[model samples]
Structure formats: C-alpha cells, structure tokens
Target: MIEFKLPETRYALNSDVSVAYQVTGDGPIDLIVVPGFISHIEFQHELPGYTAFLRRLASFARVVTFDKRGQGMSDRMSGAPTLEERMDDVRAVMDTIGSERAALIGFSEGGCMSILFAATYPDRVSHLILTGCFSRSADRLSEEAWEARLEQILRLWGTGELTKSIAPSEAVDPAVIAQYAKWERLASSPGALRTLLRLNRQIDVTAILPTLQVPTLVLHSKADLQVPVALGRKLAAAIAGVRYIEYPIGDHAVWTSNNETVPGDIEEFVTGRRDHGLLEFERVLTTVLFTDIIDSTRNATAMGDERWVRLLGEHDQIAREMVSKHRGNLVKSTGDGVLATFDGPGRAVRCALAFGSAAKQIGLSVRAGLHTGEIEMRGSDVGGVAVHAAARVMSHCGSDEVLVSRVVTDLVAGAGLKFAERGSHELKGLPGKWDLFAASG
Candidate 1:
C-alpha cells in the first residue's frame, strides 16, 4: 500500500478565525482550491483518488487546500460566510503563503465564490476553473423545491446519504460510504450546513458572468446529479470565451471515478501540455448483499412515529457498523433494510449473518441475500444484474434467513460455508429461473 503523507497544516488568519490550510508541491504556478459547502482538508484526504488527484495537479503546480471559516480544522463561525468574507479568507491564505497571484480551482459552491473573486480582483487571479458548478442556486430549483431539498439534506446529514444521492457508485462499497459519513460529520454540524445551504440559494452570479476578464475553464459532468448538466451548460454559456468540457459521465465530485482526467485537463489548460492518458472507468467484480427487515411496516406502525424514528436510527447505525466491520460497503439504508457490497462472497454472507444476529438483539427480524457478479459503478452507486439478483434472493428469504443465489454459492464453494436448497424461484423483472439457497456457517 502506498502511504500518503498529509501536508503539514498551517493557520492563516481569516479575520478573527484561523482558517486551516495545507500546501503541497512546489512548482512555479500556484493553485488555490476553493471547497464546496462542506470541506475538511484532513478528512478529505482519506478518500481514494483524492490525494492522487491532487498529486496529479501538484506535479505541475504548487497546490494549496484549506478549510474555510466555520468548517473542518478552521475556527467555527456563528453564521455562513458571505462572498466578501470568503474573499477575505482567500486573501488571508494568499497573504500567508506570500503568493502574489495564483490560478483558482473552484468546486460547486466554491465556484460561485471563485467567479466573484476573479471578477472583483482580476489582477490577483491568473486563471479561473470551475467544476460541477452552477451559475445560480435559485435557478437550479424552485423556492419550494430548494426548501424541501434543504430539509431532506439536514434530515440525513451525517448518515452518509449524500454518497447515495450524489455518488451512487461509491455507495456500493460500505467502506467508502462509512468514511464519507465521518467526513460529513467532521466537515460541519448539521445546523452549520443548513445555514450555508440556505444562503447558497441566494447566490446569483449570472449578472457578473460576462464582465469577467480572467481566462476561465469550465469542467462539468454530463450526468452530475447535484448540479445538473443543463445548469452547467448555462453557466458556461454565460461566461465569455470559456473553455468548457462536459465529460461524458460523472457525478458531483471529480476526485473519484475518472479523477485523473480532470487534473490532466487542468494541466493542459494552465500549462499548455497534456501528459496523461485517459483512465478507463472502474468496472469491478464483487458480491452484492441486500438485507431487509421482516414486517418493517407493521413494526413501524405499532411503534408510532417518534419511537420508530429513534429505533430506525439505531438500526441504521448498527447496520453501518456491521457492514464496516465485515469490510463491506453500505450503499444506502432502504428505510427498513440496507444494500451493501463486499469484495468476497464469503465475507458478504458472513456480514449478513452477523447483521441478522445484531438486528435480533434489538427485537428486529432481518433477512439477507447475496450474489456475485460484475457490477458497474454509476457515480457512487453500484448496479448491474448482480444487485437485482441479490435483492430478489432476499425477497424470497424466510424470516431471519440468510438467502443467496447460485452465483454466490458457486463462488464460495469449499470455503468452509454450507447452504441448503431453497428451490428454484423466478425473480421478478429478471429473465430465466434462478436456483436459490439458504446460507449458513
């Protein structure tokens, strides 16, 4: 395993607050990365491809990353930072680094701030790059829709739901989702994030788009869920002579999936050289596991809303822990169940069995199913025939039974696990009959 050495953290005073910053590499060109709504410089490095993504850029530039005021290692703030305050934070970091001018890589909400900063202080910015950015938050959704969205986000803030929603492919692995959940919690409190999102809707930079004098590059994904591809197009259209590249596929984040592509593109855009080849997408073979709570609706109805909500929270927490413990990825909690993936079919079955045992301690009856196949990564989510097959196997499961498909059984043969014939069953929406089995230690 390649060890990643985290850049030494330094403090840059952003007014009364100390904005935490880290610098990597020492190339001629200086680059400042503007973070989105949530950022934790330390926690972010834990994610796969993120460090490599930075390393790719660092190969040609001096890269600086920081946690904005009120987030991550930076001092907390009582309220969201306005664009002016954000600009001040940037200036503070630059001043600390003794950088006269630098290129800017803005992501999501940070893109809005970067645009304003570049336009306001053109002399200070060498180049402007926006990734998965939108021109106006309000333009993306109606007021009612935005409110509902904010509510939904806050409701699931620390539960790693963002990965499922924004990056489904990553959600297929429980480890990624679990780490992301920790990152989310460390990035900001639920209340702080709520404040930030509320003010985000008020951001309107469309009027300033044409007036920008700095050279700009707009990189967006065609299938980004958070900031729609259409909005990204409109954002690019408003800018003057902006070099825009809408990738054929990706989600909100650029650090994973086809991560190296962006850095190579940035290298070319800023330095007039393309030195890296395209990295083929990461289709992987793994076991998909599905766990469902037996009679979940009945349990919820009998428990009532308040009690059921608390109980569900416990169940979800336990589910996440078990998935992580067994080296599985918890994709998302299905209200009464969870979808996860494991590299080994045996581990997948063992996780389900362990989870089932855990759930019973809390008076919950859970069943699980497993199948092994080649799965495609859709953003952070995983899908393919294997996922559906696993779900179908679980649907046919008896109460407290860990069921699996023949694919799973075949993969784990002679691995010290045993299974009983569950009979031939026709899975809905899938062609052909499937032979199922009841899995046991």
Candidate 2:
C-alpha cells in the first residue's frame, strides 16, 4: 500500500462563511467530493471507512472535500446556507485549490448542491457523480413525516442513536456508535442541523437535471432506507446520457458496507479505467443483456410444478452455456431466463441471439435486449440504468426477438450485425423516448 501523508486542512472564504477543506494527491484529474448534511474534515480522518474512501480517491485524482457552511470547521452562521450559497462555497474551494475545472461527486444531501453547481456552471464541471441522492426533499418523506422526524432529531441531535438510521451497519458496534455520537457533536451544533433540515425541505432541483451537459453517474443503494432507489432512477432518467448504478445494500453512508466500491466507481468514471483486479463486485463499463423465456407463466401452469422446474433448470443451463460461449458473464438467473454482461456490445448481442435460437430448440421462445453503459457490480448480481434499459427493451420485444438500444447499435457497427429500427418508444419509468432496434441477423 502506498503511504499518503495527510494534507493540511485549509479554508476557503465564501463571503462571510469560511469553508474548511482538504486537498490530497496529484493525479491528473481534479475531483471534488461534496458531503451530505454534515461533515468535519479533521474528524472524518478518524473513521477507517472515511479514510479509506479518501485515500482510494487520492490514488487516482487530486481529491478535494470540504465542510459546507455551518458545519465542521467552517464558520457556523445563524442560519443554513441556501443552494446558491452552497454553490459559492464549492466555487471558493475550487478557487483556493487553483482547480479551474473538476469532476464533482455529491453524496446524499450533497447531491442536491452538486446538481445545482453543475447545471449553473457546466463549463466548470467535467463530470458529475451522485450517490444515495435525491432531487426533491419531498420525495424522501412527506411534510408531515418530515416534521415529525425533525422533532425527533431535535430531541436527540447528538445522542448517536441517529447512527442506527444513517449507518445501521455500524450501529451495532459500541465503539462505532460512540464515535458517531461524538462525531455528530463535533460536525455541527444542534441549532445548525435544525436550520439545515428546515431549509432542506425546500430543495427541488428536478427541473435543472435536464439542462446538465456534463457526463453523469448516479448511484443508489437498492435497500437505502433514506433515499429510495426509485428516486435515483428518476434522477438518472432526467439527465441526458446519465449512467445509473444500484448497490445491493441499503447503507446510506458511503463509508459503510461497500465503501471501497464507491471510490473505485468514481475512479473508473474519471480516470476511464479501474486500477484493481477483477472482483465479484466492481463498477465497470460493459454491455448488459436481459433475456426471458416468453410465455413462461402459461407454460409453467400447463407443465405442472415438477416438469416446469426441470425445464427451467434446463433453460438456465442453456443460457449459461450460450453466455460463456460468447465470453459473457451470466450475472444471475432471472427465473424464466437470465441476465448477463459482456465486455463488448457485439458479444452481448451475439449471446442474446444464441440464447433465443437455443431456447427455441427446447420448445421455448426467448426475448432479449442489449444495452451498453457503466454498471455497478454487486457480488454476483448487477444493477444500473443499462440493466434496466435492457430489460425495458426486452419487455417490448416479441418471442425469439433480440432487441438493442441506440448505444448498442452504434457500438456494434461492423461486427457483421444487422438491426431494423423498432421506432422510438417510451420506456416505463425512464425519461425521453428511446430509439430501439431489433437484431435481424
């Protein structure tokens, strides 16, 4: 492991507020990590997960993280800073570090500020990454629910019990719970958190998502207790050409559960490649294929349980064989079919075609769709907008049909592939009408 000397914490003035920040590494890329709700630059280094996340980022880019106004070492004002004021703090940090432009990463509540910054100053952001985030505060909780929650937060602002809600994975450990309690106390005063929460309810940046020109990656936990996966999907859909990845677990804190994977994903996005070896779960840019046995429900009803199970097993085996033959990874069995990924769109398309033909040999017809994008590798399963988009495309296809997105069509240009336009159709839960194509040969 390469040793990194801790960088000195510094401050950037955003008018009356002094935002505390730290900058580390000298990688070619300039990346800024925006915090959620509260942060303390010095205190963060005490937590192993937080430290590991920072070092991993420093390994590939000159990383910058700061305490937003009214938190940590920054000036604690009488009230919370609005979205535009928060944007000024980001600009001040960039100016302090002499970073004319950089990639912005927003986690949780920080995502809202990042979105506002990126849309307001497109030329200053090369890319944007959001994790466990939401565009509208109301989407997270109802006003009545939020008011009740706020009352509770006020009653137990620094009791460390909130750790159970924010970082349930670490709440069980007494030492972790104690540290979180102290960390919360030092992160901000009770008065600040109250003001911030009240202002947070007014945040709604959904309108700006569509205007963002910078490339983006939106990641959310499938089981996130605070921010639902649906909200993250909504965020990605609103942004043109945005990539979305869903982590399997629900920990909202980036420093828990799959903390390491978070930075690795950011590295791949900004650096264009991963520095580590292949693992069961790691974010990577690839093509995803979704296939399902057509009329499986009806067939299962007619075949009886025992025979249906046997046929399903056989179908799974055939799908695995086809995926392996085409150099694809069978991510998981989707009951009636399977989901797989390939390093290239051509291979993914070919694998889908093979699955369709091979399934027909066993008196089964399959529908499949292929799409290319960056995906989050979660142990044995995969989740991302590409995965969902492929499934949507597959759902639109008929028996024995292999369909693909425009991204796939463009990538497999000369791979002896032929596609017929299926016309532009609206994919459920996704923004805009997607132009789809069916693989004719």
Candidate 3:
C-alpha cells in the first residue's frame, strides 16, 4: 500500500480571478507544473500513479501544480479565455511563490501554453519542458478528425465514458480508468471543458517560438492517438536549440500510465543530468529565405480544384528540390509560400535566385528575402527578430525578385552573390529602420 502525504493546497494572487495551486517538497529548484484540461491539486495525490509521478519529480525539485483559469478551483468565467490569459494565471501562481524563475512542465494542452510562456517571458523561465504539444491547433489534427474528437468530448466527457476513449490500452485496469473519469468530472464543468477545447483549437504560436531564449525539452509519445507525434516533431524543428525525446507510450496523459518513464525523463531534463547540447556563441549566424507564389489565390481559383492541386504538387516538388540542392532546410510552408533556412547566406541567396528563375518557367514567380544573424533555434525552425525581419523584407518585393538584408551582404561579401541596395525602409513589427537590397541577376 502506498501512503501518500498530500501537501496543503492554496490559492495565489487574486486578480479579478485567482489561481489555485499546491506546493510540495523543499528542493533547491522551483518547478511549476501546469495542468492539461482538468486538474485539482488536492485530489491528484489520491491517485496512485499521479501521486507517484509527482513524488518522483519532487525528489529533485519543489513541484508546483495549478488549476488553470476557469477550471478546477480557479474562478469560472462566462466565456472561453485566450491562451495568453491562461498564461497570466500561471504567472500569478509563480508570483505568489516568490519564484524569480522556474522550470515549466506542461502536459497536453498545457504544453502549448507553456511554449507560449517560455517564448513570451524568457526571463521568467529557467527551462521549458513540453509533452504532447503542437505549435498551432490546426496542425495537431485534421479538421475532420478535430470535429470527431470534439463530438466525443461533448458527448461523453463527463458521463464516465471519457476514460474508455483515453485509457492507455484496452488492458488498462478498470479501477485506474474509473479514477481518471472521476477526476475529469470533478475538476471542471462541461462548459469549462468545451471552452478550453475551443481555445486549444484556435491557438497558434508559430510566429512567437523563435523569440524563445530558454533551454527547452520536448517529449512526445510516438504512439499518441490524441495528438499526432509529427506535430511534436514539427514543434521541435520549428524552435531552434530544442532537445526532443520520442517515447513509445501511447497515452496522452503520461503521468497517469507508463508513469515512471515520463516523469523520469522530465526529472533528468530539469536537473541538468541530461545535457541539452546547447552551444553558447556571442552571435549565431544562419541564412533565412522567404518564398511566396505569384498570384497564388488567383491561380488556385482560376485553375479550379483538380488542376490547382496538381499544379501545387508540382510547385512543391520543384521548390523542395531546389531548396535541397542549395543545402537549405524547408522550415515550413506558409499557405502558398515556403520558408527555408541555410547554413550560408550565400547559399540561401543563390537558392532563392535559382528558385525564382526556375519558378517563372512554370508560370509561377517567387519573392524571396535573405538575411544572416544570430538566430534562436527551436527544434526545426529558426526564429527571433532576424527571422521576422527576413519575412518583412520579403513582403516589400514583387514577384520573381529576391531581396537581401545588409547583414546578409556583409556575411557573403565576396561570395559573388551580387546585390543592388534598395536603401532603408521601415518594416512593420521590427524596431528601428532596416537597410534592404535586391539580389542581382
């Protein structure tokens, strides 16, 4: 029999709304664990698996778990709150604890909010740990799949049937499954659950990720049914300098089942036992390329559905091949455009030039922008003011043209990639003025 000594649960810093949390252990480092959908700090310790996981984490650091705003002990609002608002609740809990900085451990939907926090408030975080997370809600599951899942939640979430849909496996102990369903019902109202799910579907943090400067560890079960593992991989790739660990557990709730392994990985990541393999340089240099199709919407509408799909496939193949030829990594596809990264500014410039020239033959024109600067690497993508600057530069150019920032010019001075200065321009969302130039033919 496991005798769990439960910690005293308390409320912290009441805004118009207050957040509820519990503090346990007396380790040197402060660790804050954000809940997924429904969490009650007081009730959590009663579950054997949940209790064991927390105790394990507490061995290395003081653990803090909190109910998110509008759920559990926190005040319930009339409407669904934004991810930013939920993050404020997390901040409130931290402030209450007098924590200068803490390692953030977020599970499931909590993982998305955690990423946003670490990116938005790098100074407040010592490290970030995300499990089963996605950069955007749209990318996690397809539209049809999302609708189906939502329907299941709405129909069965509180009916003691939610566990049937989420158990680690069919062989899971019935007692354990019933315990989870009970917690789900106790921790949140149906309205609150629906609202949280809505927010999860609409959340997008792809743009803000590159600005994150803290050490990050991303973990996801390769066999997770709720959130696909590819989304996790995409998240890791989008953020520069992120360490990703893939586990084989199919459960979305890691601490509940297959409990030991999940918490152990988190403990290792938080305690510095695992080297995140981050390098320190005064300035890290990388090339940024932004490519957009010419008259994309018009082309899609004109070509109709079938023909347009075929054309886009051809365009994707061409762009991918050209990007690969120049040793560029395809960061992501932005609707009709593609964003890529290169090791050398010169290669990026040449790739953009070649891509633009080749695109015209296919009745397409690509606008590109290149810059080199110290970039914060999240798993697969490069980010920071530099990445945004490159995107802004791309916006100013016309179809079939490639532009380069002055920083890129300095890096590839004798690379034979000629450029004609476009002079200074004020870019939106960027501080100060920037010097821009057009790539020469």
lDDT (CA) per prediction: 0.87, 0.85, 0.78
Tens digits of per-residue lDDT for model 3, 51-107: 656766777788899887777777777777788888898888888889989999878
Best by TM-score: 1
Best-matching candidate per lDDT:
1
Tens digit per residue, CA lDDT, model 1, 269-373: 998887632222335578899988899899889999999889888899999888877767788888889999886788888888888888999899999988887
RMSD in Å for candidate 3, one decimal? 22.2
Supply candidate 2's per-residue lDDT for 320: 78
Ranking by lDDT: 1, 2, 3
In model 2, which residue pairs have backbone atoms overlapping below 3 Å?
A: none
Candidate 2 residue-wise lDDT at 246: 86
lDDT of 2 by residue, 1-441 (tens): 112357889999877778999997787889999999888888877653676577667777888999998889999888889999999999999998899999999988999999999999999999999998999988988788889988988788777877877788777666567778888899988887888989998999999888999999998898787788899988888989988888888588877768667787877887788773344226667899999888889999999999999988889989878887765788888788788988668878888887888888888989998888878878778887778888899889987899899988998899899999999999998889999999966
Which 10 successive residues of model 3 have the least lDDT summed? 274-283
